[model samples]
Target: MAASDNTPATSGLHQQAVDLLHALTGRADAHFHPGQFEAIEALVENSRRALVVQRTGWGKSAVYFIASLLLRARGRGPTLIVSPLLALMRDQVAAASRAGVCAASISSANATEWSQVLGQLDRDEVDVLLISPERLNNARFREEQLPQLVNRMGLLVVDEAHCISDWGHDFRPDYRRIKDLIRQLPPTVPVLATTATANQRVVHDVQEQLGVGLVESGREPVMTLRGPLARASLRLGVLRLPSNTVRLAWLLEHLGSLEGSGIVYALTISAAEDTAHALREAGYNVEAYTGRTDPADRERLESALKDNQVKALVATSALGMGFDKPDLGFVVHMGAPSSPVAYYQQVGRAGRATERADVLLLPGMEDREIWEYFATASMPTEAKARAVLRELGEAQAPLSVGALEARVDIKRSPLNMLLRVLAVEGAVEQVQGGWQVTGAAWHYDAPRYQRIHQARINEQNAMLDYENKSTCRMQMLVEQLDDPQAAPCGRCDNCAGAWYPTHVSQQAAENATATLKRVGVEIDPRAQWPVGLQRLGVPLKGTIAPGERAAAGRAVARLTDLGWGNRLREIFHTDAQGAPVDQPVDQELGRACVEVLAQWAHDGWSGAGRPAGIVSMPSVHRPQLVQSLAMGLAGAGRLPYLGELALAPGHPGGAGGNGAYQLASVWQKFQITPQLQTALDNMNGAPVLLVDDLVDSRWSLTVAARELRLAGAAAVLPFVLASRG
Candidate 1:
């Protein structure tokens, strides 16, 4: 537009913005927070870059929506917001609609509506458009749509802007693309970045990236407005529960007595589901919200909680960040999060628009273990990154993740993250089919990754200190976030005294114990070989012939389950040398094994009649553990124990990787032993029970069962102690 158009607004323009705010909020009493007006003014009037770091309920959305309306009214183009999550976009869309803003999202979830949304954008019908940072990596979106949008865009907003910084608690490699997006935008276009949880380091990092580097983009210096990170309405407390059983019992005892609709955060998806199940059985209206939840069901669940139709949603961190429910009465953490910053963000969800709300942390003993798993999962390994690079470098055509997995040895989540990082570094490009090497020069920044990793460790230790604090928890949290105005709230448990009941009913504890003691989750068989395995030289593709596939398997428990997960995790814990050294299955676990078999039979997932024989998959790390479990089951069930499947010289086990690579790693490693073949031949086609210690990828079970069936076993019913997701 013109220089005059980007100048400060007149009184009439400011009044029109105020009127638009009222129309958007539908409340005559609606007023801006301390810096909200300044943020809006900077974006709408001066076309300036601004960073607003306020608390969760500080009306950051209002600032953007109002600014978008004012800009659009002045004949500027629509606002384009780069949001971090789908939940945030959904809430923002609804909030925008409330203000008469014709907002729409072009996201992975709304592919069918993209053309319509694009048409709306072209016709100047859309006032706001929300999209994920990952969308910028889309070939078509980056090449076509984004360039046009950037040319006419009135304002740029980056929600959860802290994610752009590697120093941030939730540093997403995808958000790094925002820097490129910001660089591509018109120099005169207004820009706003907002986040609830960013320390000084993160703030400066984000600001530098936002200013298009420390050199300032030849534009006005970015305006930073960071407020105190404190929530007066939330009463924080850390309750050190003795065990998971005690924690569940405490919830059973105290949840109903707590205030309005709220959320219960669990560290893992299974924990959330199990806690939700336990709470439901205790007659509390609750539901589970996790990455595993279906998109439509998640919407329903979120709506149900928001409308107060459900008491709470037992959720992982997936339910956090842009979910808006004003009077949410309480926020409880089933286990302490890895960082205080993350905890603050979660507890901030409660008491957003209330005088007082309860926020408790029912800290568990298993918290550290769970923390370690996630911490390791997020960091990219040099070996794995180079493996991905080497594989991509050799591929003749663009390959999807599944195809990449066949060639590379990395898990799906980490692999996806690495691809994004590589894309940002110009080492790779995401295309229509999948990803391709861009043939761009790339260097491994070991020092940078190490620095970030060390920062995370420091954060983790700080969180542990927060859990152990005798002083004000709220004060500690704020200081950790680097809030200059940090102060004790006099509302937390440490500030006042224990306001929560410490007593748990004996019956509640018994019921919790009973529920937790229950085990045996069905493990679904892999019906088809992973795609592109043939390219990986495994020579396998398409459906596993029905006859060759293992029968639907059974496990004592998932390694992530709320029940046997704790023990199984400890048993399978990796050593200081960074390799797993397994422990033998004891008699106590033997009893649990019996229970699993009984439950399996009771459920009839396993065919009628006990297994005629037993075969165990040889373990690279835990032979004794696998042997003992198989032998215990064999003796208990009174079935003949066949020999274990022998490794055909070079099977390295599944190790850790995606399905196709895992399959390739184990495909040629196992063979039916002569002794087992003779045992199977003698059984005259009677079903045999195959046992293993861990079921990570299920490739071992599939391959082992295939060998057994080839040796004439009628059916191979695979069993494992733990199923790792």
Candidate 2:
């Protein structure tokens, strides 16, 4: 059906949709946005698949909710919406209730309500049901509930449809399953996919996926209704401060002046938490939202921001996508995201229902380094994929992730991601017990992965260009998103003048510096040995012996810390020759280490008293740095300096492996040198501080501490310059 097909029947449907929209928004005069009514008409009247690419506040929800109510009044079943975020689902469910559409959602956060939701669905009392894409692979749901839901689905809605394409910035492997679900849907079911972000490539890919099995069935191709992506309400600008402290100081001086409560996005969780702490210390009502935040706390934080109970929520990407706040007044970025498209999507969250909102980016020098780390992390390696496949093929039964971790070198998070990719490629299947090979031959898509990796690099460079671009910032973003309506908005700092304050008070700068300089990150000791270590020839299982455990330790700062992180990153940074640089601890860092030690002493150790001596871990990469830090601390404290631990002969010194393999590689790798033993004997059972340049897995510290404890030391307290959290 053509968008221009507005017959008398379509007109009547439009009138009803407008009425439903009014009810949804609590406005008697509410009307559909430019493309909303057409998309709704295509879905409701023609039962055609449609993809609506509109701006954030374009009433995509209104289109779907109104269509669902219309379908239900015509005796169609409940709409099945595969929403990406819990925040999105909550908002949709509440909105559905307001529109008098009975909606229920089944998500991991609401497992207790599953039975109730299922009952409602069975009783045909639910007009719309929302769920996460991951739920589609749940064994019980896939086998029992999903089939029934598919059979009776009045309409299929894929929220955040860009995730269906790998070209999308925020693609999820589980979203690939949506294509199969769409293929399985009945021919009569109208499908609607909605998103506010997607480049031309991503849009085409999504179109192909959404059109699965429909073309062969003689149904119309998916109709795409894309509107202009530019937002007239956002005044965008880039503010380049010299250091993290100064940038934070700017926020301290100016955050309150923003129109309303908004978000400050950081690239890393540590940055977000650190910024939130600084703001709170300065008496700002703020909270941190990150991937590590508890689900309940996340809900509370979202509500707090929505109700304007808090001034702002300092967050990482965890707060992006589908978080709705119509009157959000400002959006500040502590660091630029890698892609212009992603940046646009996040900033679009602001100025949605307001006349004007400020969007500022404080580009960090460390942003590229952080971007490279994530880019590499998200890409799957052929060697690791093959290793996973070989292990599963040889296994007698399905293997749980833990068991697979024991056999493969990949870490847990990356391993889970690789498995999802494999499952999507049809090489593996997740079952009740665990994951199993499906006997399907799989080829590593080297070219495709390479293209994606290069695409990320290009995007990162494009982001840099965005920061430096003197033309319209919004136009650059829309063009990057392939929005044809891209043009100078005449409102950004480039088009107009900088609308934000750039001044930072001396007092605020001092406070920010103090916040950054504050040190001591606690390192939790490994309480229990990693499971299945016995399979790797290590006889460790269950709880580690208390006598062998190191006391909870401390690091001067995390490698990702917004303050000292840059300084420490320089210390551990690799040289041009691609080898780790070894250097002595600078006076500044040494003083910081002393500060950490002083705080630890004041706080009191958990299982030991003040250190009587310092012993350094043998570092293959940074021996000089490790020795310098330990000896310097020993001298400053006027304590005996115990010699460093010796590496066992033929010990393999390397990194990058899972817990079991990491433990195996370092098992018995550290030996108590004769010099260290002599120093320990003189300490008379006093606690010794074990120093290392960096701590990644903590397995090395655990093993070295065990050696020290067995060698007559009463306790070992681990300390490091930085932690790789």
Candidate 3:
């Protein structure tokens, strides 16, 4: 493409920046926002590092895009963007394309395209390359591709830059690696970091990290542009529904009238899915977007919402951050987020390119439960971190995650989180096969994590305050971010009155109860054994042989489910006094379990005859819970109750871990009672019902079923009260 006739002849950098900004925005008359021009000038003319903490829709992407164009024109290399999510990268790539910039991404969603993207980069045909933080730890990428790219990178842009700070509401251990990365970049290269949800503390930490390895040059001071975060387009409100029942009913009654296509946020994936299902049944064209959503399906759903073909998206935090739709109409929270900053960020997604978008929060008593669970999930434990280091140090070669799990007792998710934390701290380095110790002395930084934990407590309290505050809701939120510009907005319920209705009809309430009362969740069977099982002395490999695997099992609901999760948590949660005592199964949930089996039977489940007998899995903590469930099911279905499966004297409990470790822990560990074997032998070929409290890794069920099948049971149908994801 040729330059415009209006392109000024041999101009200064400022004129060039202005021209590029117009091209970037596709508006010849487009000019920069107050701080946008300054940021561009800092990056392009002065080659200064900068951090921009402005609201969403403030053209943070434009700052880097326009700056990249100007620098590349001067023969600088491609800008490397460390993006956090696929949705963000997709939007940025599209946004850069509209600006006539060539951009490509390498992420899990496009693993097949990495070589092509690398080829493009090799040819210098890419203007920007977007990669996840996890990519930085890829040994091959770091040792081979990264050094070359880092040497020539014209500018480094950290989108969602607040994540670089541990103090940020959504702290990611992977993002901590950017500090090491920044320290390696040449001082002459400019860096720009951008986020929509940082306060003073987060801004200061990010700014300090952005200044890493930049001590040599006489670059300008790191510019910090923080504008007032109050978005006047949002009309905020809080609806304190008495229960999840009333909340779902209110949505059933009022969702259609809310506004144009938008997002309805739920705190958990289960809630998001259940809410979407209920809303769809009520004739709303809604869909659920969660971490579990298929990548292709997420793309499809996002497109549907963008095209207004869907009413609203029911989504978890998975849908948050840099999901761009200029005309996204509103955002509704079914339950409050853990932090006001997080809440602000989700609500910020709405009203970016619209006027007067509705933002409402319906707080729940269960919100605190969810908060407590997730707040401590990523905090590093000294014992776990030390165990990983020891494992890696003692290994002759790098151990893959599966191999590492077999050696260590930690579950996969927490283990992976610890690995990332160790990687960030320079204690462990991911290698070709798996991971290795770096020999770097690492401390657990208890104070920092403790501060983060307490900060979460403070944030939770602030969220509650926002819900019940007599002052302006919007002001309270902005203030929670420590924004100096916070002020009362007359649009909130407290400021004026609620712009939303508070009433749900009895019919809608009944519909919600019907939806919530519905039970049964699919237990995804383990199709393949964990890798390196043979190394762990278990012969299993690829697929679990068809006959030995349990049939698609049945559970009333996941512990995360909105319908039964509440009661299950009550049964599972350790109270202030101590651990949950073993209690009898609730009659309603027991009936729900019966309902699940009944439906399974209707769906042609009983091949060898409706379960010949019921057997309970042995439980050290909740033996009574298991017994009560087995007895109730046996009574309701008129089946004989076989006593609990026997365990060796010192047999360990069914704690969750990866497949190989769990299987190794329980392999041949259960002893079939002589009475049970006699009972099974007498049946001559009959299916048996196996019951348990919960299923996580499912190795116990698998091993137990293998034992039962070996002991003459024709088929084993595994049932559980709850499944943990």
Best by TM-score: 2
Candidate 3 wrongly placed segments (more than 4 Å): 1-15, 215-218, 531-542, 573-576, 606-609, 654-656
lDDT (tens digit, per residue) of candidate 3 on 116-208: 999999999999999998888788888989998998899999999988888998777888888888889877788899998987888889988
The sequence of per-residue lDDT tens digits that candidate 2 reaches over residues 130-188 is 99999876778889899999899999999999998888999989999999999898888
Question: Which 10 residues in a row give candidate 2 its minimum summed lDDT?
Answer: 1-10
Instruction: Give residue 158's error in model 2 in angstroms.
Output: 0.3
Using Cα atoms with residue i matched to residue i, what is each candidate's TM-score against the true structure?
0.95, 0.97, 0.94
Which model is ahead, 2 or 3, in terms of TM-score?
2
Expressed as tens digits, the lDDT of each residue in 450-474 for candidate 1 is 9988887888899888888787999
TM-score of 3: 0.94
Alpha-carbon runs more than 4 Å astray in model 2: 1-10
Which of the two candidates, 1 or 2, achieves a greater lDDT against the reference? Answer: 2
List residue ranges in candidate 1 displaced over 4 A: 1-10, 213-218, 573-584, 607-610, 650-656
Q: How many backbone clashes does candidate 2 have?
A: 0
Provide C-alpha RMSD values for all models, in order: 3.7, 2.2, 3.4
